[model samples]
Target chain A: GAGVSQSPSNKVTEKGKDVELRCDPISGHTALYWYRQSLGQGLEFLIYFQGNSAPDKSGLPSDRFSAERTGGSVSTLTIQRTQQEDSAVYLCASSILTGEGAFFGQGTRLTVV
Target chain B: AQSVAQPEDQVNVAEGNPLTVKCTYSVSGNPYLFWYVQYPNRGLQFLLKYITGDNLVKGSYGFEAEFNKSQTSFHLKKPSALVSDSALYFCAVSKGPGYSSASKIIFGSGTRLSIRP
Candidate 1:
């Protein structure tokens, strides 16, 4: 792909439902990341995955949130029992490698009704 | 843990005038600071970064930033502002080792910069 791509640009889910956001990082990128931006808030780091390494999940807001990257190419972020506070723009980014400038996707606007 | 703080939520500047957006950071290791601009309904675009060496670094759109280690600040500046420059600006810091090898970047709340003509 020419750039990072995210699926389901917008999602509206019930408060108790589970939602999965996906990211396809730029080809050859060794690093992928997920962040969330709540209304009027900043980009909150959620998770980071580097080639074949353990992902850093310290930034995940709660245990309800989890992510997995397979084949070092694509990733999926899952949020269980979504709450109203979960309404936010989920952003995905990929860098040539960690510590380099990262390119971002347009983002998926997740709204929990 | 590395974090960035964009002090002002909004900054207003007049066209052809100089503009500045303040940023401060806290990092455990070497600080890697960055600036990004987000246009309306668009994704963030990279502006510049400070990895090592020089205190002054220049970036896209005729913008520049000064890294002051003494102050732990990396302020974005432009000699002349343009209405097109109006956008949401963010400052970010890279989390060093002991965290993710991927070097996760922590972003600030963002400052809405409005350059009026």
Candidate 2:
């Protein structure tokens, strides 16, 4: 891909429903990251994946929030029993490697109604 | 812990005038600072970064930022503001590899820069 791509640019789901957001990072990028951005707020770290190493899931806000990256390429963020507080933009980024600048996706705006 | 603060919620600047967006950070060790810009309904774009070397780091779109260790600040600046520059700006900080895991990049609250005609 020319740049990071995210699916379902906008999503409106009822509370308690499950939603899945996808991200396709730039080709050949080794490091991928997931972040959440609320209205008028900063980017919140969610998770990170580096190559074949164990993913860093420390930033997931709660048990309902989970993510997985397959084959070190496409990634999915799944929210189970979503709450109103979960309404926000979910962003994904990829970098050439750790400690480098990251390229971001347009983001998926998930609205829990 | 590493964190960043962008005190101003909004900064108004006249076109062609110099513009500044303030940022401050707290970290356990040497800081790797970054600046990113976001337009309405779009993803954030990397502006510049301060990894090491010179305090003044230049980046795309004629923007630059100064990294000041003593003040614990890395303020984004531009000599002349353009109407197109009006957007949401964010400052982020991460601890150097030795201090913490590389995945954590703590972002500030963000500042909206508006360029007035």
Candidate 3:
């Protein structure tokens, strides 16, 4: 697809288990971002990867949450020991640069039970 | 710091009626603001943006927004509302030129727009 693509549109995971969400950004995009959106809430910034620069993890809610962008293309968000509060739609976006507008994926909806 | 706010949580308008969605922002110097919309079970779609040039910016789907520096508001406006326009609207802000900021965008709480038939 020309736009950003995410895998496993929906996931139901058991608590205390681990889950990984994947995102494939648009080709040629140098910047990628991850955000969390709970029900009836706005998007919360998570981590960001820009070229070879260090990612900004300021918005990461906890240590258990981590993400990595391999080869500056594919990105994965991993959550360990899933908790109910961790349930939300994980959104991924990619852009040509920091100044350019981003293209978003449909996002992965994860539910922890 | 940079942030955006949508004062109304929800807005209702009859079909063919004019509609306006209010948005405000606060940032250190100038702001590069944007508006996005989301339909049911979808990610956000970019609508319009206010960068430099003109204060009145036109966007997709017959939607336009006026940037008011004095009021610090960028209200999305449509001449005629359509039933299909019912969805969630978000206002976001980022650091503009001269400021060293990343692609991080701060979104508003989102306003649920309901266009009645």
lDDT of 1 by residue, A2-104 (tens): 9999998999999999999999999999899999998757899999998888998989999999999999999999999999999999999999855567899
Off by over 4 Å in 1: B95-100
lDDT of 2 at A47: 91
* TM-score, cand. 2 vs. native: 0.94
lDDT (Cα) of model 1: 0.91
DockQ of each: 0.72, 0.67, 0.67
Rank the candidate models, highest DockQ first.
1, 2, 3
Q: How would you encode candidate 3's per-residue C-alpha lDDT over A70-97 as one tens digit per residue?
A: 9989999999999999999999999886
Per-residue lDDT over B1-117 for candidate 3, one digit per residue giving the tens place of the 0 to 100 score: 677889999999999999999999998777788889999977899998888889999999999999898998999999999999999999888777677756577789999999999
lDDT of each: 0.91, 0.91, 0.90
Chain B TM-score, one value per candidate, order as shown: 0.93, 0.95, 0.96
lDDT per residue (tens digit) for residues B50-82 in model 2: 888899999989999999999999999999999
Which portions of model 2 show Cα errors greater than 4 Å?
B97-101
Superposed by TM-score, candidate 1 places the C-alpha of residue B8 at a distance from the truth, in angstroms, of 0.6
Candidate 3 chain B has its poorest 10 consecutive residues by lDDT at: B96-105
Between prediction 1 and prediction 3, which has the larger lDDT? 1
